[model samples]
Target: MHTEHDWISTPITADILRGALDLEHTAHGVLPHRLPAWARAQSTDGQLAMAEAQPSGVRLAFRTRATAVELDALPTKRVYVGAPPRPEGLYDLLVDGRPAGQASVSGGNTLTIDMTTGSAEHRPGPAGTLRFTELPDGAKDIEIWLPHNETTELVALRTDAPIEPVPDRGRKVWLHHGSSISHGSDAASPTTTWPALAASLGGVELINLGLAGSALLDPFTARTLRDTPADLISVKMGINVVNADLMRLRAFGPAVHGFLDTIREGHPTAPLLVVSPVLCPIHEDTPGPSAPDFSALGEGRLGFVAMGEPEETASGKLTLGVIRDELARIVKQRVAEDPNLYYLDGRDLYGEDDSAELPLPDQIHPDAATHRRMGERFAELAFTADGAFAGRGA
Candidate 1:
């Protein structure tokens, strides 16, 4: 049912890539990295390493008359040693800034992880090819959005016609940082991630730093935001800190202040918005270190449970509700001196009412529809005429 064509190979280069901070040449091909070498070198946490390598917003952007396109990529697939298999990573195609097609590759290296033991093992495999055909005729801008949750090494690019990098369209660059929810967890594809959808609706270029389980207020991460070139910036905080139970109230306030201070160093007058956690009943009033619920493992479903006690908040434990209040207070205090700084309560994006209509399937991450809803809501609140991110020239 399939036939091979005379494909013209084109060397993949940095000029055709977008959203990635760094590109590393691997044995098979080039791997996109969300974090620079110096930033990655500062952390030994395996979670941070994996998250940064997933390339949530990375994509190939070019103009071509190619009616057919083929890409060879070796993706490092992840598997939980005992959990149900995850769906293959998806690649989304956009033509002239509109959704056109989607595809997935089959074989790649596997990284099996054991949650209980915090151990992992890697097994090598070969690259797989993805092909798209029957595209419209004439020259058009084509963008291949890489998988947000997979560590993909781009091997080869081939097409029926010559290709060239797309010229800058003068879109405003929006750099956002957040947690797993912002990292496209449970989202249908990379381009449909809340931030991606919001960027599309807002008509801005995106550089997403939504590191899963790694959005802690790290100095290096702040430094990364400080140095990156962006017209608009936002930092979504609280969810990861509460779930990880990484710090208490005493440490959280100063950490947030210091983080904001670092970012202000380079972007002195850029409109900066700090977003608090969205509604999550489990850790809203209660504190956390959340843990996996193995009771449903037999049913091929996994869920999370908050491990901390509600009373623990009396002693300075973090919770989503506490975080929202604190974040609002901090922004109000800083706004007097820093007129460009602002804040948005995450609930405005995904509140209790929205959750009632679309409950989180896993009790933490939003479903595909929720991602869309959140994206639309964000565009309304932040990109509207009188919104915080409004009035920026594209």
Candidate 2:
């Protein structure tokens, strides 16, 4: 109900954005990219392209006195073919580092994806305005977190008063890369994602390179890690590899070594932690190119099923268990020479006991509560005294 003339429009510049590697100028507006343009040009997969454009950790951060703020964005929401419609993605508003409010745009573009055939169709829709009103009266730091799952193009930012980009708070920057789990799947909102929550608890700035269905050990991705600046770095490996059936044990070992080598090239002494996949019961022993289970589609539930046989591991197929052992051994071997390199068994974050209480809703991704649990556990293990990221700074 706001009149356009009454609000002041602020240019959505790079200075106000955080956690995105690239900003793509689009026909409609600006789109944030987790991967750089050069890295994206190297891949032709629609999945990776879509994932990178989703802006898992991106946010608009500024200091403003405005009590009313509105953001006009065109979000590209995903619709799984034959599955129940998904809810509108939520935009979280944080005031002075605390959650203030949450809202969602009513309508936007839709990308209908057919998992069975790996096909996607896009249907354009009008942009929607998300308004947050009656914020704190005085000047305060504000952050608007973009939807972690949807591809959102920022059209405009309107505030009742002027806003300036928030200055750096001298917090350590943690760069993390992984698969869809790290990409904020099934999390209630962007700030509630495990990494986001962990970053908040640990008092660090986050640069999340967690690409969904696309965390294969690509050279470009490794190079992306190598090029980005960070005080602490972590790579949660194995889940995607096991679920995609992407490589064998023999290939995985070397590929991981190469990835670490690339990262070390840029951050030789930064605390680097290598995390194995969290315990996924279905893929703990079973190998897979996991597939969507539509059996519960009629009931409005979408689940995943393992497609590979358990016995395939004998032929060198990768499984979560095997990958964990391999990652532990690799980190153990490398730590002898590199004192800063560390390893964490992802099971330590979420294990059998935790799973019994908070099972993964889709049989792959953790639900919102599980994300909170994992985030707390991670902060306890990695950010506490004597932890891997202890004593780190910006």
lDDT of 1: 0.92
**Each candidate: RMSD to true structure?**
1.5, 1.4
Model 2 gets an lDDT of 0.91
Cα RMSD for candidate 1? Answer: 1.5
The TM-score of predicted model 1 comes to 0.97
Cα lDDT for residue 155, candidate 2 = 95
Number of clashing pairs per prediction, in order: 0, 0
Q: In candidate 1, what are the lDDT values of residues 1-394, reduced to their tens digit?
A: 2356667889888899999999999899999998898999999999999999998999999999999999999999999866888989999999999999999988999999877677999999999999989999999999999999999999999998899999889999999999998899999999999999999999999999999998899999999999999999999999999989999999999999999999999899999999999889899988999888777665667688899999999999999998988899999999999999989999999998998999998789999999999999988899887787997736
Query: Candidate 2 versus the native: TM-score?
Result: 0.97
Candidate 2 residue lDDT tens string, 337-366: 999999999999999998899888888999
